[model samples]
Target: MEFNPGPPLLQSAPRRSFLKFTGLGLAGVALASAGCHIQKETPSGRLDIGEHDLAVLNYAYALEQLEGAFYEKVVAGFYGGASALEKDLLTDIRNDEIAHREWFSDVLVLKKVPRLQFDFSSINFTDRKSVLTTARTFEDLGVSAYNGAGQLLALSPFLNHAGKIVSVEARHAATIRNLLNFGSFADSDVIDANGLDGARTPAQVMALADKYFVTKISVADLPTH
Candidate 1:
């Protein structure tokens, strides 16, 4: 997929009300209605994440939740001296992540995992560098998560959905990169010598993502191949 350097596609609704309708405000209700009755954590104090397609989708769902929360917090109170472009881009990305999280919930229904909790005490939202750098990290991790999980998806629709979402994620990563250092949208750190984007297995992703989560996640049931 090609990365577009233009401004993010904007949403028409006011930012204040968007989350109320789509984000964490309704997350618990959505999962409940979807019939995701699983306990939040097992006896070992970890989330199982399920198996096969469900596992992959749950993994994606977990990441989306993390990204959605991060962006929501960032947009709610932008960093000091934040540019108008920064606010707009972050707001757009927040909306996108909320949409992605809800979409996965709607699709997974009975198989969806419980809504997980997060702890962002380590991030300084008021600091510009910290916020954007974290945004860059989450976006890049998201792209790699989808890329690495693609091979494990057993169904076509899930695979197609992942493809569509990852392209948008790649754009987010590119946008953040350019914001940090102009012309570094597809920098070598993410894009390799063969012009291929990076990919990370479920275990590798969780290793990085775990620090921000209050909910312990277990990928033991997730397909390795």
Candidate 2:
């Protein structure tokens, strides 16, 4: 809206080129500054994800589904006074999340994996603090989730798929972070001592995601061990 995005955001990192970007740390931690609620849970929502490829695939799928729905709602009722740039940025991210969701869904379909159901009542679209803060959380979560799921991929080819998508997620993370604070494209919270982006296990991720889901996800059988 009326708030400036601060300095123009640096362009998002290119494919597999995140390492080349020095200050690209995770500064979205500030998202936690805001608070928000849950609407309802869908009794039938289930992940049914198993070991290796299936686990990694569904993990990404679920996260994409969550993010896509999040952005969709954000656009539908954009914060009270959104600016043109703000609207465009959120819409672009929405498109990216939707594309990511479709890519995983297409792949999962071949394996006969069922679609996912998400509930966003937990988010309060009317509040800018709640909105941006939540956006920051999802973008950061998406990037880290991909990083964690990378090494667990079963087949070599799927790594290519993950790689392609993670860079995009990283871009989304950077943009969202910048929107919160001009120079926050990258911050120490998400980067490790080795200057690498941090990773999270399936258990760790599902625990946090369960809060917003209408259905509690079951990743209990995942070989994330």
Candidate 3:
């Protein structure tokens, strides 16, 4: 996969609506869906993130960058049999992810966060199954990534901000799942026995996300306090 430097593609939607949607948050929901649980890690050379809030924010920015890039490529050459609706839907999602990416970048400005390089050569945009499956992986991971980062958030406001983003991510996951196979959204595959969706840890998310990135993710000064 080639690493390209530039802004996120396909963000022409009205920014007001997107911002309003984000501000709305996930109010009045029976089951608040989160990310995959971060399990204990074995021997792996993955990067270790610090306990600092900025580290957590950096983690989020990295994933958003990946997801935004993935959708951009998909919309650029939508899979075979993709309809107008699919194109528009994915484009809107692309815009949202890019919005999320930019939001994190703004937050991390003082920290001097580096733009990440991504790998999408494995995804076959010409095939619907490949594209949808990859979307599912990303959406799931994104939700779980937020969840994993949840406990590390030291401030309520930052936690609230993360909640808004992850809830939207869960919505994106459900949309992709339903598209893959109607009614597959929130099935036994993702939701737990208690009906609440799961969340993952930073290490776990990084492990799962290793395949999508060409640049080795290096985390420095992770907050441990």
Which numbered prediction scores highest in lDDT against the true structure?
1
TM-score between candidate 2 and the true structure:
0.76
CA deviation > 4 Å runs, candidate 2: 1-47, 110-113
Candidate 1 C-alpha lDDT tens digits along 142-204: 999999989998766567667888999998999899899999999898899999999999999
lDDT of each: 0.80, 0.67, 0.70
What's the C-alpha lDDT at position 202 in model 3? 68
Which regions in candidate 3 have their CA more than 4 angstroms from the true location?
1-51, 219-225
Q: Compared with the true structure, what per-residue lDDT tens digits does model 3 show for residues 72-101?
A: 899888888998878877888898898788
Q: Considering summed lDDT, which 10 consecutive residues are worst modelled in model 1? A: 1-10
- What TM-score quantifies how close candidate 3 is to the native fold? 0.76
Off by over 4 Å in 1: 1-37, 40-43
Residue 134 Cα positional deviation in candidate 3, in Å, after optimal superposition:
0.2
lDDT of 2 by residue, 1-225 (tens): 111111334234332232123221111111112121112222455545544566567667878888988889999988888879889999988988887777565555434235556777777898776888899888778778878778877555567657877888788778888888888888899877787887887778877778887645566655653
lDDT of 1: 0.80
CA lDDT of 104 in candidate 2? 63
Order of all candidates by lDDT, from best down to worst? 1, 3, 2
